[model samples]
Target: MSSEAFRAGDRPVRISVQIAPQHLPIAELRDAAVHAEDLGVDMVMNWDHFYPLSGDPDGLHFEAWTQLAQWAEATERVELGPLVNCNSYRNPNLQADMARTVDHISGGRFVFGTGSGWAQRDYDEYGYPFGTVGSRLDALAHDLPIVRDRWTRLNPAPVRRIPILIGGAGEQKTLRIVAEHADIWHSFVAPDELGRKLDVLQRHAETVGRDVADIEIGNELRGADDAKAAALFDAGVRLFTIGVSGPEIDWAPVERWVRWRDAKNG
Candidate 1:
């Protein structure tokens, strides 16, 4: 898709902060959510996992959607969601209900970010099926539309049409699902890989008769690299995210990205 096709007038480059919830106290996590909003972050995200991805797996952890409920009550400005909630964790209808409730709690400031299950540890420890990638992606493809449909049928519908963000770079099933269901597509690939993934997504969009430009591109930042961000911006990514772990949350990188966003806006 051409960049011009996706361009909105003066849309500021958005920076997001993903808080590693496993390592922090709930109170501290709440405080961090408030602080992130205070710091002018475009969005705040938490990972969906039963154990810590970094540090000790047994150290500390929190559930994704529950934390999001607290965040919705705690913050006023920043949009919030799980970076990617595993599709196998809950019933699709239940997930939609939870997201809709949170959307109402935040007064329509929520993004429904989801993904096909990964992380063998989470599945194994939590007793969720540790299926093959293909199987998980298949489950995701089936569940996404169910979630969307459930949102419409629920007694109190979502405060807004919650934007769906599908996170992954799988060339076949995952990207195809993103093209079909996602309003935002989040991936962790490098710039070159992102270019290829965009091609895959475009191909999928063509098959579905949808415009690839309708989906927003989101990428995780490896570090503070303006040149790299520029490269990604050129590749059609507008949302850039950085992950920070607690109890020593580093706001430096986030601050730098905010500055970079401001400069880009100027």
Candidate 2:
């Protein structure tokens, strides 16, 4: 699919919720996903991590790809994926294969959101090398093509052209990678920082002969209010996401954001 499709902000606002798989039981997490779908969320997401990012250091946490596979079976309408997958955790070819299988399972609702690995604890515990940021980004820049090439060779193929969402805003390397491979760029930078980073991304896109506007803009609304979200939308962010952590998943914020999205799209 060409990245030059619907500009989400100009068309409809999409709201995705990342239900963090920490401090919660499996049954509850499954139920939460079902409920989110029923509540009309546009997308559902989880993090790729071995331990809790906050709260208890060793709190209960589920792996990402496994849970994502389960979600593909459980929910029917909402698109689902890792909020941002760590590229270093699995081989690029394996990641492509897993993604293709899940895309089939979901009937083409998969969005391949990924990034270079970062969590030191995850690396130490799992025994993957903890390299410098530049090296990690270089690895990601290298692996994305392998993932794409594997996608083409897989039997039965992906249900559709799977969307690649790259998360990060490093102007030099990360943005350049987004320009090259990502259909969606998850710019975690605040609204004020978007223009400059986008300019950098555009420069990179120019070098590759792709349209920079072809990439959709995404942002997190975890610490944002309506005004902030509106500002981001005004600045061209069409994908708004909020993360809810478990064992006490809050539904109110999800509802609020859904309503906000509805209002914006209205």
Candidate 3:
């Protein structure tokens, strides 16, 4: 695992909220993001999907990058981005440029969370080829360098070396990509499952010549509490994201996690 395996716990815990982009008015979504920032979340996020993942397939939806542009301007302190952008949807260079623009728009608070992409519906309905999983991952690997190089060439430059957050638990390709390019690696594994995955991630990191400790670990707070947070913390997760949907925004769980974060950090 090298020296990087246990380093994530040294950083302060961060709380993020993923406001799902479906079945709600744009105004409501905007307001929810604003409110979350007001409540002191360390980050705010939205999903990158053309259609709703649940409820109605044809429900109201907003585009990811455009909404993020708006969000960049809306919140003042919280970091922001798509929870996990589908790499196949946009050109790599274009993706890099958009990320740079958003970084500027957010005054350097954007976190580039992306994945190889799943969801056959997004591809079939949008005219993208729903190729095999291996193909999509291959696309992600090919594009990431272009994205990074584009960032280097952009005018004015990004305010900071924008953090790249890669989401997925594919022990083979995804973790390898994370080891190569990501500053943050997000996963949706159970606490019990995390140790094994982190072991896999560290082994992949070693193969890529990266110190696994250099990457921050991100996880979802789906019904998570103090105990779950403690267990994940022990397993090396530091950035915790909570998923919330709209019509009405809930604060209880968010506050609970925030308190847990502070306690953990303290």
- Candidate 3, superposed: residue stretches over 4 Å from native: 1-4
Q: 34, model 2: CA deviation in Å?
A: 1.0
List the pairs of residues colliding in candidate 3: 4-213
In candidate 2, position 265 carries an lDDT of: 78
Per-residue CA lDDT of model 3 for 125-217, tens digit only, reads 899998999999999999999999999999979999999999998988998999899999899988889888888888888898987788998
Per-residue lDDT of model 2, residues 5-101, tens digit only: 3244355789999999999888788889899999889999999989999889799899999999999999999999997899999999999999999
Worst 10 residues of 2 by lDDT: 1-10
Candidate 2, residue 240: lDDT: 88
Q: In angstroms, how far off is 36's CA in candidate 3? A: 0.4
Evaluated at residue 55, the lDDT of candidate 3 is: 78
True-vs-predicted CA distance for residue 26, candidate 1, Å: 0.6
Q: Model 3 residue 72 lDDT?
A: 92
Deviation from truth (RMSD, Å), model 3: 1.5
What are the per-model C-alpha RMSD values against the true structure?
1.4, 2.7, 1.5
Misplaced by over 4 Å in model 1 are 8-10
Error of 3 at 146 (Å): 0.8
TM-score of each: 0.96, 0.96, 0.96
> Which of the two, 1 or 2, has more TM-score?
1
